[model samples]
Target: MNRWKKEFSFILALLIVALLTACGSNGEETNNEQASAETEASEELTIAQINWAENIAVTNMWKVILEDKGYDVTLSLLDMGVTMEALETSELDVSLEIWLPVQDANYLETYEDTINFSESTWFDNAKVGLVVPTYLEDVNSVEDLNEHAELFDGNIVGFDSGAGTMEVTEQLIEDYNLDFELQPSSEPAMLTAIGQAIENEEPIVSPLWSPHSVFSNYDLKFLDDPQNTFGGVEKIHHATRLDFADDYPQISEWFNNWKMDDEEIGELIDYVESAEDPLDGAEKWIDENEELIGEWVK
Candidate 1:
């Protein structure tokens, strides 16, 4: 071949190679863009919790940490059964409040796959037995109540009708065949009845739990549940939907590592419950315990 023809062939070969390289890079860039779009589409998370102090306390505590991480979290309020069903169906992303041993054993046994139940943050600081003001030393056990039903005005003050503790309390009453009646009321009303009774040193029985400021403020004692209907040592279990770990691995890791000692959580519960706002307690708790919380966040 002539020199001119050879030079033209060499230039054509270089141009073809550069064109192929550019095409390959553009294809890779498109693929990357699609992958990133898929990831962004899955970023938002949903979490659910029942209407109670501890459930409210722990769920929102994690919420603050997650929001700080630039995540979009949606909170859904649900009853225990509803929360379980929602989490199982993936309608709910997580249920931060799982009370153990006493938590619906049937649900845990059945829907174990639909969600991830964190074991690390589990701690036993809540009790769901019958409770009364310390002024009533005569009532210390469930069995003891059989004899003093009249003294209690034959009434048991319970929280919202659907609450797990309330259900257990109802079962306790039925099993014991106590003449006492469990009067279901809204949380605020229940507290008002309890606070009023306490103020007067009147005898009262109510379905109660811990990390509650009321427990801290009142000199209350839990009556021995011989039946153990309300699991003697209530444990806090962090629950999340199956996608939680896959979608928000970092936040899930932090949740698994996150924990609040009894005092830390209790104080947080106090801030929210006691403030002008009946809710929004978790934010206050997070703000107050930033030092210890930083340990978990990092």
Candidate 2:
């Protein structure tokens, strides 16, 4: 009977050990499953990027960053109006550059309740109006543009026809009673025209904005808008679909936290313009500025 009792106790101890081991294995499996689920939570994202140089630089920068974090990102180069429409219809995940209180006021007013606008700014001090090369000594301000319209070939070179600046420029011409025609062209075309003018040392005035690398590449001055019709200094904001936060809380959080000042944006635009592949430049920027990016994601 004593031997039998000892044997029974040994078997009972072995069974308890086996049960504990099985429980431990199950607990580890549960943890791993939870981790995997978390890793897969955020879905692929679509970014609606405008073709403006600054917008291109910022959007591509985020593309590289997000892809590195295991998120698939697609960029659609669309005009501002279409971009805004996509955001409103939930067809786009995010719009990285939305100039506010002036430049993009029309769209924002239309979609104010439908989309989400970041409370903060990626960049402030954004002003838009006629811009002239600093070498044009006679041209000082928007009011002065009319006096020297012939010097600029009777042209107020404008940006994308769909751009808010062009819309405001139309108002500006009427408001100031300027005799110059606001030439409707794309941003690239406007820049190229301006560049050619610069090379020839010819005078040119166009709808341009600050926080643009063109100002750095060529000495340019923003013709002062005394009437504030251009709407003073504007804020560059991130506009996302209404459900963006819920669908991609992490990315939405990153967008909300991300902040780039004028100098940073100018540097990015410079690098992108110089690089053969804009994504390569964006990656280089990210690699060099890991600490700043870490703060953004954190």
Candidate 3:
């Protein structure tokens, strides 16, 4: 009887040891999995966003999409010049709208060595030039502006001074030998001026771009550029740091495949403008266009 009892006690001890070993192995695996997940969650990307409507819309859209894919994304609001500089120094990962061959030519020339532009343009029909309300019947071209300088208070309202479009406008003023002054202001301020002018049937001229919600909201016309000061239809591209593609291969691939038509971008801008938070608008658009987004992300 004594031998049997001793044997039973030994078996119980063996079972306890086995159970403890199994528990310890599981705990280690759990810790390892937690660490791996934390590492993935910590991966981050920063995008520079210009305050232009299309840039705001697209930037927010990407922010939401990338976040859903386990990336911590940040958007920095910056002027056109500052954005280019940041991209050159590798401080920014991406810029959604970099108008090429015209508006942003100077920036491209300055940062070409350190910046990389996507081979594919996201928007192809982009244009920039002075614009006026349709009610200004006699003012159909940039040349007409000089004849009716008094109507616009001898001033051509413009976007932020750092905008590439503003740079081209200054050249336009010089090229045409216009007597009017170019007043640099924020986009929202320019829009407000235009809106107020239209409400009272007053004449107002300002530099404007396409793929903007303003075109849909107002009866505006682009003053014909006889000298091609603003250049022909410009293509909007994605600009990134030189090493961004190498660092984020998957995102680069998605960006390369991205393209948006006028109607689509217009809708996105409208949605964004209507929402209290831009991200909410972007999320709503994404939910509605899952199939379209899947093609790029896939």
Candidate 4:
């Protein structure tokens, strides 16, 4: 009887040891899985952005959204040329605003082989051309600019010097042989000029684009482009490095599904401009548009 009891106790001890070993193995596996998931969630992504209002609005929106999704996102403020170069070399992961088939045709052609354009554009019907206030009745078209050159103070207010718009405007001057100068300034500076001119009811002509908040804020009209120097309707697209889609398939899919109407984008830009912090405005817009965002992220 004594021998039998001792044998039973040994068997119980063996069972306890076996159970403890199995539990420890499962805990280690769980820890490893958790660590892997954390690593993936903490992955970093860098996005290139320009100073343009629409670009700023959309870029900030994505930054906030991606960060919320457990990603470490960085916004790199770069010019169009630099942004294209960075994308080509894979130095940047993505750019949220790329006006295609017109405004950024040259860049697209140059980097087409190295970069990946989104399957679809987010905003359509975008346009770029010389714009004037509604009060400027006499100047109704690009052809009219030369006739009323004196009224515009012999200047055509333009955006950044290296911008695609500026390049087209230069060609426009040559194509029309207008007696006016193209003043290259930043977008904000140009907007300030337009605001002051409009307030005083002075005549001013500047290079402007659609899907911009300026159109919502002021009564402006695009001068009829008889030469079509600025090209026809542009589509706003996002682009990524060539391998970006493969590495981040989910993000690539989200970009593919993204779309915004004029009203939605305009409201977002307005919010971004009104807020002291652009990201704050983006966060607010996201909160209000949860359903739309869910469609993208889901």
Candidate 5:
């Protein structure tokens, strides 16, 4: 009887050890599955892309960088209004081209409660105004455009009719009591008109923005808006969906630390415009500016 009791106790101990081992294995498998699911969720990112040159450049740059880091990024081309709406609905994950102080006020206000603005500026010294060739020395300010409407044929070349600059130009016209008409056209058309005017030494004024390739290509000047109708020296910013930080903390951190000066953005614009494929240019820029890129991503 003593021998039988001792054998029963030994068998019970073995059974307990086997059960503990099985539980440990199952727990590890569950933990691994959870980790894998989280990683997969973090790998996908959706970005709202505007048609502007600078937006294209920056968005493409980020797309390339993020993909290199094992992300699946999608760029959705949409107008500012649509982009803001999508962001508000959580359909869009990011936008890297939010111009502040004047250009995006209405949209910002509309979606203020639903979006997150980054803490840092991606590019600075952005400006918008009536621009003229430097040779037109007499046309020094927005007021001067009023006096020389005839030189521009009573027309101020303007960008998209829906653009914020156009809205401000209307305000400027009302404030200054100018008689010039705002000729609505595409950005490329406006640039073409400027180039033609410059070639012929004809006086031409257009609603133009800085950090543009045209600024580097042509010697032009932004008319002083003493009335502050156009807003002065705006900063380009980043905007993300409300849950971006909680969902993709790593990317949110990178965007918060991102900063690029006027020169760097202009160089990027130039490289992108010159390259046959814009992504090729972005890749080159990334390789050349690895230190700065590291700072942004780190």
Candidate 6:
């Protein structure tokens, strides 16, 4: 009977050892799960900003603010068309320069499912026009220009051949029955002609747009388009991926809260346009507008 009892106790001991081993394995898995949760909580964010003056300024402004708030922020490249595609695919987390109801409106509606853009911070200070030197009072409107096509050398100065504004200007040409050739050249060439004309106090007209500091730099005025062929004044804004809210809520909030005034952005644009150093211009504006910068935070 003692031998039988000894065997039974030995079997019981082996069973206890197996049960304890199973419990230890379950505990390890739980600990692993907790570690994984912590890891997911510590991810970084990426943002895309286009090459435009206002875009660079506001984007860098947000970048500075986000980095200050302990986000691991990264920047990516953006083109006019490529940026939207990136935002749609979630390859880019955020972009703060979506201009609405124009060239980008169709894309905005199409990609509504993939990204969300807030209109509260949207600014509406942009304008497009056929402009001339401030001294040209006679050429004050699209109709006014027909009498002076000979004065403007029978050619309407224009930037790159394939620019959308050029397309609009061409349409305006057909619509108005203006007797002028749309001179197509690079931006530098067009601006060079304007500079030379301004120095000579000669007549000059070209396709121009704003929040650009061109009006401030040189005495310039936009000719009135009674038919509104070039479109209307509107704000440039931001669109970010749907994942932006989930992955980087803090950064998203900072960007959503950030905005700059028309004048403030123009000063930054002038600085960059003069020297071609956009980031430094943005930083300089931030330094000069300490009060405004603080307000943007609030």
| TM-score for each of the candidates | 0.80, 0.86, 0.86, 0.86, 0.85, 0.70
RMSD of 4: 5.4
For residues 118-196, what per-residue lDDT tens digits would candidate 4 score against the true structure?
7589998899999999998888899998888889888999878867788889989999898999999899999999999
Candidate 5 per-residue C-alpha lDDT over 34-153 given as tens digits, one digit per residue, 9 for 90 to 100: 786469546788998776778778888888888888789999988777877788889899988877888877777777888887657877788878888999999898888767777888
Model 4: residues >4 Å from true position, as ranges? 1-40
lDDT of every predicted structure (CA atoms)? 0.76, 0.86, 0.89, 0.89, 0.83, 0.73
Which residue pairs in candidate 4 collide?
none
Instruction: Give the TM-score (vs. native) of candidate 3.
Output: 0.86
Indicate the worst ten consecutive residues by lDDT in candidate 3. 34-43
Worst 10 residues of 2 by lDDT: 34-43
Return the number of clashes found in candidate 2.
0
Write candidate 2's Cα lDDT for 1-298 as tens digits.
9999999999999999999999999999999977764664546779988878988999899999898888889999899888888998999889988888888888888899999988877787787778888899888878887777778778888878888888988999998999988888788898999999999998988888888888877988877788988988788889999988876777877887888777788888888888999999898888888998998887
Candidate 3 ranges beyond 4 A from true positions: 1-41
- After aligning candidate 6 to the native by TM-score, how far in Å is the CA of 113 from where it should be? 4.4
lDDT of 3 at 71: 88
Residue-wise C-alpha lDDT for candidate 3, range 1-298, written one tens digit per residue: 9999999999999999999999999998999877765665577889998788888999999999989988899999999888888888888889888888899899888888889977689889988889999989999999998889887889998879999899899999999999899999899999999999999999999999998999888899999999999999899889899988767777888898888889888989998889999999999998998888988887
Q: Cα deviation of 283 in candidate 4 (Å)?
A: 0.6
Regions more than 4 Å wrong, model 2: 1-42
Candidate 6 regions off by >4 Å?
Answer: 1-49, 72-78, 109-115, 153-155, 159-171, 177-190, 271-277
Q: Between prediction 1 and prediction 5, which has the larger lDDT?
A: 5
Model 4: lDDT equals 0.89
Positional deviation of residue 226's Cα in model 6 after best superposition, in angstroms = 0.5
